[model samples]
Target chain A: MRTLFAAISGGLFGTGLMLSGMTDTRKVQGWLDVFGNWDPTLAFVMGGAILPMAVAWALTRDRSPLLGGSFPAAPDPRLGHNLVVGSVLFGMGWGLVGLCPGPAMASLSYGGPSVWIFTLAMLGGMLLAPGVRTRLDVMASAA
Target chain B: MPMDWIYGLAGGLLIGLAAAVFLLANGRIMGASGIIGGLVDGTGRSNAAERLAFLGGLVGVPMVIALLMGFVPDGAVTANPLLLGAAGLLVGVGTRLANGCTSGHGVCGISRLSLRGIVATCFYIAAGGLTVVLFRHVLGVI
Candidate 1:
């Protein structure tokens, strides 16, 4: 049952990637074009998604997430160095290869080899998470 | 381009299943980024069942789709492998610093109606948007 639901979610996300042309690195790259020959489609897609989600979050700060979980959903918006640093890292990658997890997984339906490389690297990143967290914790404590 | 509803349904199920299972069994959200980050951040995994299971579906489904549907990726794909790996790593690191991914914050957290989640999601969308502009437009990687 759990697997079923997760599959559905991934399917929806993957489908979105496909429909939006996110699976195509070139499309993503094209959207990345800002000033010259900027394809504003991606911005519109993102904006279309963000507003509703933002409103929902603002309204539901006190409520538990629909899915049962250990932690109550609460606003923990990071406005410090973390946000900028993380965003920069994320943007850097998004700009470079045009495949984030959501889209990368979606692209696999298309079966591109580059997507495979990304998937492996992403898994590697997941694997390295513990040590990084510890280091971050130590640094925060020291600071 | 119109998205196929069949795929949407499938994706939705995967996402929902991952979320429900992770939330119930592991007491975690089934955000791949967060799960991966937790592995890195030195914290004992609060729950791994749903995370692993959901992640598995994420990859497995694509292969299955290709097998079952005879889906072939477009022939024009020519991305640099090294760059792709770098992007993945950056995303992982970003998840670590942000404490959640788009799935976690954008979908689950926002659904729960948290302000911070909203902020996080905003940052995510904004970064992603600006990134397209900068790399694709300003720098022109190719």
Candidate 2:
């Protein structure tokens, strides 16, 4: 039942990403191109997504989740070095190719060689990150 | 003419609904990077099946939709392979390190009023914005 719900959610999310034109790298790049021909469509997408999610948070604030387990704890707000460095790196990559994991995976059917290569490389990077994170953690504690 | 904003809004709503569903039904945040990362790093071994199920749906549904609708975006195919690979690597590493992405941080986090999510979103977007300026306007490399 849980897995089924997860699949349904993932399917819906992927469909949403496709329908929103987020699969279009050019459009995503255009949105980020503030000084150039800035497209405001992604903003609308973000705004629309936030409304229901906000309501969901409000509705589920006090109760345990409907399916069974306790709701996730609130995210920690500490200013960590990993967070800053990672975000900056991610941003540069996003700028280079407007393919984040969600969109990249969703576009696989049609995305050809470039997408394949990107996905493979992304997985490699993911595989390597744990080691890097451990080192960063050690450095952080030492400082 | 493309109903760009309308599509974006409608799609965004669906995305939110998906997030809400995952949260309500599974008691988990619908973060792609985190979900996939956990699997990769063996951090989510306990919930491996659930994560795979979610991803299967994420990719499977789109495959069917694209097949049925013949919806293929042409612009994505032309990217330089090397750059594409490099970008993917950065995204994978960065999202894991940061612990969220657009869906998790931008939508779920902000909606839940999580300061970490908000801060992460702001910084990544700002960095993304700066990257664009440097690449497109100043360097003209991309």
Candidate 3:
């Protein structure tokens, strides 16, 4: 049942990515290209997504999930180095490729070898990140 | 008033609704990187099946849609292999290090008013814009 729900959600999410033009690298880069031809469609996508999500959070506030597990607790509010630095790096990559995780997955069917290369590289990075993060944490503590 | 914006908005709503369902049904955040990352990194062995299921749907449903609709979604990924590899590595490491991606932080976190989510979103967007300015405008390498 849990798995089924997850699959349903993932399907919906992918469909949304396709319809929103997120699957298009050109469109995504255009949005980020503030100095060049800027595209504002993504702004609407962001805004539209936030509306229902805000309400979902509200609904979840007092109610438990239908499934057995508990809702995720509030995240730590501190602006940690991991959050900032990782995001900056992620952003740079996003700018370079105009493909974030969700759209990257959505595009796999027709995205060809380039998509495969990017996905494999991204997976390799994911595999390496934990070690790098641990090293960074140690460095931070030592300094 | 462009059709693309309308499509974007409608798609955004669907994405939000997907998040809501995931939250309401499973009580978990629907973060793509986190889900896939956990699987690759071996930290999420307990819920591996669940993760794979989500991923399967994420990958599968679109194929079905494209087949039935007869329109392939264009990703327009860069043909440059080096750029693609570099970007992929950065995205992979960065998302794992940060513990979320655009879906997790941008939509779900911001909607919930989580400070981490908001901060992450701001920094990433700023960084992405700067990269575009540097690479596309100044360097023109990518």
The reply for model 1, stretches above 4 Å from the true place, is A1-4, A43-71, A128-143, B1-30, B36-46, B67-69, B75-78, B108-115, B118-139
How do the residues B9-50 of candidate 2 rate in per-residue lDDT, one tens digit apiece?
A: 999999899999999889999998888889888999999989
lDDT of 2 at A57: 84
Q: What would the per-residue lDDT of candidate 1 be over residues B7-66, giving only the tens digit for each residue?
A: 433434434444443444334454556654554554636544544555556666665665
Docking quality band of candidate 2, CAPRI definitions: medium
lDDT of 3 at B16: 93
lDDT of 2 by residue, A14-81 (tens): 99998998878877888888999898888988898899898888877789887898999877868688
Question: Chain B TM-score, candidate 2?
Answer: 0.94
Q: Candidate 1 chain A, which ten residues in sequence have the lowest lDDT sum?
A: A52-61
Please list the residue runs of candidate 2 whose C-alpha ends up more than 4 Å from where it truly belongs after superposition: none
Minimal lDDT window, size 10, model 2 chain A: A109-118
Q: Give the alpha carbon lDDT tens digit for every residue of A23-107 in model 1.
A: 6666566666555454545544444344444444344345444554434434564466565556556666666776666667666
Over 4 Å off in model 3, which ranges? Answer: B72-75
| DockQ for candidate 2, C-alpha atoms | 0.79
Q: Give model 3's docking category.
A: high
Question: How do the candidates score on chain B by TM-score?
Answer: 0.75, 0.94, 0.95
Q: Worst ten-residue run, lDDT, model 2 chain B?
A: B70-79
